[model samples]
Target: MEVVSSVRTPLITGGKTVGDVTQDICVRVEAKPPKSWFLAMAISLTFLFVGLYAVFTTAWEGIGVWGLNKTVGWAWDITNFVWWVGIGHAGTLISAILLLFRQKWRMSINRAAEAMTIFAVICALFFPFIHMGRLWLGFYWVMPLPNTFGSLWVNFNSPLLWDVFAISTYFTVSLVFWYIGLIPDFATIRDRAKNKVSAVIYGALSFGWVGSAKDWSRYESVSLILAGLATPLVLSVHTIVSFDFATSIIPGWHTTIFPPYFVSGAVFSGFAMVLTLLLITRKVYKLEDYISVQHIEFMNIIIIVTGSIVGIAYLTELFIAWYSGVPAEQYAFLNRATGPYWWAYATMMTCNVVTPQLFWFKKIRTSLWATFFLSIIVNIGMWFERFVIIVTSLHRDFLPSSWAMFYPTFYDVGDYLFTFGIFFTFFFLFAKFFPVINMAEVKSIIKSTSTSDKALK
Candidate 1:
């Protein structure tokens, strides 16, 4: 009699064994950080310092340092916060929601996406905190503790408070999800440890796991439970972020359609971001076999579908504004199309509405360079989408006397640069230190699909 283990075989192509898969991931994960890592770190650190300097200068001088005026109160800081938060959504959606849906393809890229989510949320946090000139008292906005200065309670009805709750919850949950998934891989690294320092560090992180059957069982169960917890959380985070605008009395922000609209846009941009990162990681790490053309094509389809939903939302907003017959609403819609910020509006339409249509072709979707370019376009469009929504609509309120144009000051621009630095800086570090691909998930996928490999081949 012979004993067979499913874990030993290749699940997809049958061209490689499970050992091959593990070896491939180990090689990449254990490799020394490249020269590019140092270069990127130096540049990002420089920019981060510049960003901090600008923030402190603004804080010391007052909010007057920013281009934001009484008429246009929320400027680049708030816009960047919303944009980065939306970008962070794609990570949890891919890891949690798609995992629950049993999408095997997500296994190849979920690790990097989850890392991106955590980092993007970190970047998002800077805006709300620093945007308040008196950063020391920033906690007053959310703290339920009694304040003697004014004896005023924090506004429970305010969407800003909701943002504080929603973003904090989203960030904490994402961090836990990411760290949990890394435990097994960290143990794998621990066992393969070649030095005392590496052994102790990895051992401590792995939590004394010996990968027993019982441990694997509990691990799998915990992952599923966490995924279940994260699914609604991913949706709720963006929906609440939308309420920050939708609950407002401003014309464009007052629409009932904002929650779904923002969620779809968040997913669309999030997928775009995931695509951008995975494309590079697969190439850099030589995991083309794990992150295959098929995976890229599947995600492209998602990008197209969600992109179309966002495109429809754009048109529908216009239709509803007209049909509502509210003068303020109609004017806001008209302003988006033909107002002072029409250039920004046109840029959004081009990037969000038109550029993504190229993915309808399989050639474009699978072409790494093409997808990369489109991803940047999608990001640019998404940023402009927020800009157009926040700035253009507020530039001219209900009254002509209140109308004003908004432009970003140097501090405003520095804040945006800082956000980019934060996102890329964390990503660069992630690529260096961790297995950007989730080895455990990929191994499981390989194990489960081994039988299908024979038939396909």
Candidate 2:
């Protein structure tokens, strides 16, 4: 017989019952959205329009319109690409890995986190296409197609080519996994939906879920299968992304530690992004009972672990540069800390390294305001970390005569703002339509007497 301890705090607070969980989550879906949602949508649309104009300018006049010197061919584009990709990492980790571990706390946040992974990956994909100058003409070049198709073959040796394969596969798997988890919840909404149109739409999305024993058995099996498939991707996707730099011969780019290092940094930033969005969402949607302080603390603990790993990785990079006794490598890192872009490096260390350490104090980690503020600070630091890694390393060349600093044009900021517009806009819409909390899973947790009995005893 298995024994369970009741010593731990409740994962779902407020003494919520199965019925309470369903009603609370389903009401958000059934009711008309509040005025605040409309106001928020209006602001996001404003940013979206600005971003669209910037993308249009880049596509029309070419990437040459932005500042790119001979020495620094990559600037904000790759930096933001890596940053957004990193932001997407936490969702799969939270959804797949935690699910595999049989962690019950994930029930509340997995829906939004999985949705975040989808949207963030979409935003990350924009850079490489835009970087090609004429995305419409060159976009197909990256497709993992047969050379025999005779549209010609992609350069198999290119790191960009590998990124095309890895990120796309990651996106496809995440989308399916997210949608799969939503089916039963969709069915719930379908049953509760009063309008004919609402019933029809949700019924279709649910794919005829009937809550039968056989249907549930199949659902559990499929979720496990998909979770197993996604678990490796959490580690592999970021590892492959790290290869984009690690496989290079550049002084700062070549490193063996980058795979694990990148993975940890990705989780660090990803969790911060999740917290940033979730904190506001719970308050706005009045989901405090489902997403409680305990949940926030649990997430904060993970942030601490990942943040420390990232901090160690940062120090490891510095140590390797010193211990390797390679002048170019030494100068490369030294330039990052003391060169023209030293401020960026400083910001990265302070935000990613220093701010997260504050979570060591329970008072701060559990405080909603502190968690939200630091989460934003962590993401800002991560963006600067990418910028410092990309621009600082490239700005100083072998010869001082060839060295040049990269400067962003209007498009750089605008393209980034474009992604912000896309992410928040889609997120708000998702919150408005779908059950933000996983209604099916939350009900199961409360309804499962077998699990609750063990804890009760």
Candidate 3:
């Protein structure tokens, strides 16, 4: 009888056993932070400080501290918000969608991906609060609670309100899903803890998780239900985000294709971010056995497919603009390509549309250095994609008299850097203190050897 394995190759390479998995993950957490970790943290701290300074200046002075005028109100901040939000989708996609499909390969990488999603959402949430200028009032006012200011309710008709609900829901579900998955791994760490302090910390985190048949049965059922719940968020969150633009009457912002286009672009950028982090993480933590080249190649293929879809969306936007014969819509696309911000549009095209095509070649997709470089490049393109959609559309409006160009102040650039600081700071800490790879799930697949592979034997 021929036995079939779901994955083409064994995910946990280097002949690792369950004990080996525990030791490998636990030691990293228990050990002191490495020099590389310190160096990365130092860089993140520097950026974080710069961002903090910018935020202080902005709050002190007002939104006027950055670049905002009548013509371009939603420039860098909203662009960064949407960009970060989109990059977050890959995490939920990997954990929820892949789980529902029973893709065994995801077991090795889902933990880190889900963590990334949570952090990315945290970063994304920062914008709406900060962009409100009056952070104190804006944050609270967005919530639909009865207040001293009677009848001052949130506009339910607004897509911005939709964004508020959608993002909060996405963040909550992703956090719950992530924490639930971490329980078993926390238990593993708890059992392996050598010190009293470490043991207590892990015990608290594990929530009394025991390696029992009953516990395992309950765990699996809850995970499935959560995955079922989170799967729609993988689509709905970005779709609502797209609604922020699609519902608007602004020529470039309003479009039927916005939902699917935004969704594809979100997933594309998200996979790139996952690749970016995993490649570095696998190397830094010596996790090559768990996060393999095959995994990298698989994600790169996703980038290729989604990048192509985004490229098509770009062309479709242009074609639709022309076909509609609406002067405002047509001018928006033409201006985006040929306007003063043409550099941005060109950069978006080259990075998002043209760059990922390289992955089509087997050599490039499999090459670690190439994949890492392209992943960063893909994110850069995706960021500029948002910038083009926001800044370019707003800079040149229907009225020539109101036309203006957006130039980012140091504060604008600094605010953007702040999100990076927060993202990496949280991620690096997660890597150092937790099992970056999912130990419980990977253990189950360690022996599901491919028919021709001798690694298991």
Top candidate on TM-score is 3
Give the number of the best model, judged by lDDT.
Answer: 3
Model 3, TM vs. native:
0.97
Write one digit per residue (lDDT tens) for candidate 3, span 148-183.
Answer: 765577899999999999999999999999999999
Predictions in order: lDDT: 0.84, 0.89, 0.90
Per-residue error at 156 for model 1, in Å? 2.1
Candidate 2 vs. true structure, TM-score: 0.96
Deviation from truth (RMSD, Å), model 2: 2.2
State the displacement of the C-alpha of residue 422, model 3, in Å, after optimal TM-score superposition.
0.7
Give the range of the ten consecutive residues with the poorest summed lDDT in model 2. Answer: 447-456
Across residues 1-457, which tens digit of lDDT does each residue of candidate 1 receive? 2333556433244354567766777766577866666887899888887887777787788878889876788878888898899889989988999889988778878899999999989988888888777878887756766777545777789888888888999999999989989998888888888889888988999888888999999988999999999999989988998998898899998978888889989988888898888887777676777777777888888889989999999999999999999988998989888988889999999999999999999999988889889998999999999999899878887668988888788888877787777788889888877767787777766645544434433
Q: What is the lDDT of candidate 2?
A: 0.89
lDDT of 1: 0.84
